[model samples]
Target: MLSAGFIVAVVFSWIYDITPGGIIRTEPLPKQKLPLINKKVKTYRFTTFVSVIIIIGLLSFNIIDSASARKIEKIDKTIAVLPFTDILPIKYESIVFDYIGNQITAGLSKIDDFNVLPWRSTKNFRKGNKDYVKMGDEMDATILVDWKAIEIEGEKRLTIEMIVAEDEKILWSNDYSIKNSWTEISVISTEISRNIARRLRTFLSLEERARINEIPGSPTALYNAYRGRSIAQNALYLYEMGNRKTDLSDFDVAIDLYTQAIQVDSSFAEAYANRAVTRLWGIYTTHYSGNELEKCLEDIEKAKSIDSNLIEADIAMGFYYYYGKRGFDNALKYFQQALEKDPANVDCLFYLSLVHRRKGNWDEVAELSSQALENDPASALFYINIGTSYDYLHDFEKAIECHNLAIAILPEWPA
Candidate 1:
């Protein structure tokens, strides 16, 4: 009976071990299927975050690049030609004096990166005084060329002095004397121009030289242009100094002079531009109707079409767009285009800053105005713009500083 009972016990144990319920089952722990999460979906989310980061980095880089480009665009350097003095004592030989001056101005203007004051303006200043410092200050000239010619016996002895000035102080002065026959005057003038260009190159950078040399024309065409330019320039001077009410007779004469210049050379861009300027002035200052404005635009467009690179055309167009039509967009476009053609275009930069200020872009106004000041350090207008920009930004200290600088430069302007 004991053996039988043991045997039954062993069989029952075997039966329990073989049963599916009695087997060591895992209790089916809620069938945890890893929360049904997809590995690829998580990978896609991570990849999207990385792509967004890359896109932001690219955008930031573009923004920085654009800012840097604008900053580079603002850099400009300029040089000037002072009035050529005639030391000749012959009163009737004033024509010769003007001839020599015209030659010198023409040669220098042909050199790249030079912002030569027109013969008209220089002649006007020279008519009043011979002080180099005062003339340089009035014209905002960086370099001054003072010339004297004495007719000795039958030969002409010319004395030329190149004076470099900064802040009314002469930095460097060099004197050169040349003796030549009447026929050799052009050769002598060419030599003088070459020497002055060399000296300018020494004082100026390579980029500046490139700018001066970029104008397109043959030597003969350039010389002829200068002749025509001198005529128009002299007329412009007469117009500027003459009063419209008291000098209406002179105005007619000045207009005739300008017309004569165009007759001398139909391709003379400066003459056209200056005539347009004079007409526009009449519209602005006199009883002229809007007809003058339309005619001015037509002449300027003609001038630009003749020579797309004419700086005067660019400036006149910029003025027409900015002040006449009040089209700031077109104004800015022409100004920027002019700047691209000649980085040292002070007028373009000046008006560009003004446009920025009018648009309420204080930072851009400050930047462009400061750049204009650098290009034309003696310009009171630049200082005024700078001060205005600072005032707009509510930086009273800087505004005051700019105002003081402006007053120091041009004490005649009202604060």
Candidate 2:
């Protein structure tokens, strides 16, 4: 029995020795797990994640905003005011019509943002029986101001309507009525001007409105200096319209008109400049050379002596240097100078592009052509220059592309 007990005890000791160490162990170890995260740390982590997200969103928004700004910057806005219609009741009231029309025109002229047609041109518009839409297109007018004055109950009532048309579609229109009063004519004129300006402000900025408001008026001279200036301007317009025979007579008339204007107001810079152009035209179209050219130069110099800031004088000098004398460098210098004075001067830009092309400066030709295009995108001559520039640079495909665009814009050669 004792030997059997000994055997059992020996088996128990072997089982205990072969058992895993943790199962046999009796003492418990101290817990060593990390403490639960505090609310502050969790809040910090969440805030950091949100801040990172916000930063990324802000950066993306800025990038998109900058791209949108660039696109908006490229858009250009232009406006033109059409000729005002004469609204007179009687034949004798034509003089009244002229006075009222002149007043309205003078008021609108104060605003610089708009290209206002001169009263003389507007008056001549009725002579051709031209369609108002076609006239608007020819004059590049975006807005038309139609006005009528009639006797209502033996009292004069002036009705004025403003229309904005593109492709003959009326975009906006408004009517204004005013009673005639000679004593308050200036006040009435100023009111009409302000209303027109306000309507324009819907599309134009304040600065542009101010520009339209600053147009100068005819000086109070017995001879009507502004009227004389208008006659000279019309003569040049005729010359540009290619009526050489008529233009020559008009030039003579312009000379007389400008001389009268200068007599009335010696400080009339425009009269001197236009007279210089008229004199230059005489030398150019009369087949006069040598002494005539010298005479033309003297006349232009006198014009410059009268007003150093005249753009026409610079243009005249440039043309003389380029076409008459073939002095390309001098021509380019004067052309560049004129462009500096008026960046939107199409004549100067066109001449400069031509001179650059002649000088084999293809880059400058392209640059000047681009500037001219900005001023007059409808001009086929500018596109032709662009195409030629590309052709000279061996960019045949681009040359053809530009030529095609030019042809598309102006289908006929003289168009």
Q: How accurate is candidate 1 locally (lDDT)?
A: 0.60
Score each candidate by Cα lDDT: 0.60, 0.60
Colliding residue pairs in candidate 2:
110-212, 110-213, 110-214, 110-215, 111-211, 111-212, 111-213, 112-211, 112-212, 113-212
Q: What is the C-alpha RMSD of each candidate to the true structure, in Å?
A: 24.6, 20.4
List pairs with backbone clashes in candidate 1: 111-212, 112-211, 112-212, 112-213, 113-211, 113-212
Candidate 2 lDDT over 245-364, as tens digits, reads: 664565566567667766766665556555555565555555234454565576567768877877877887886777567799998998889889977667787888789889988888
TM-score of 1: 0.52
How many pairs in model 1 have backbone atoms within 3 A of each other, for residues 3 or more apart or on separate chains, i.e. clashes?
A: 6
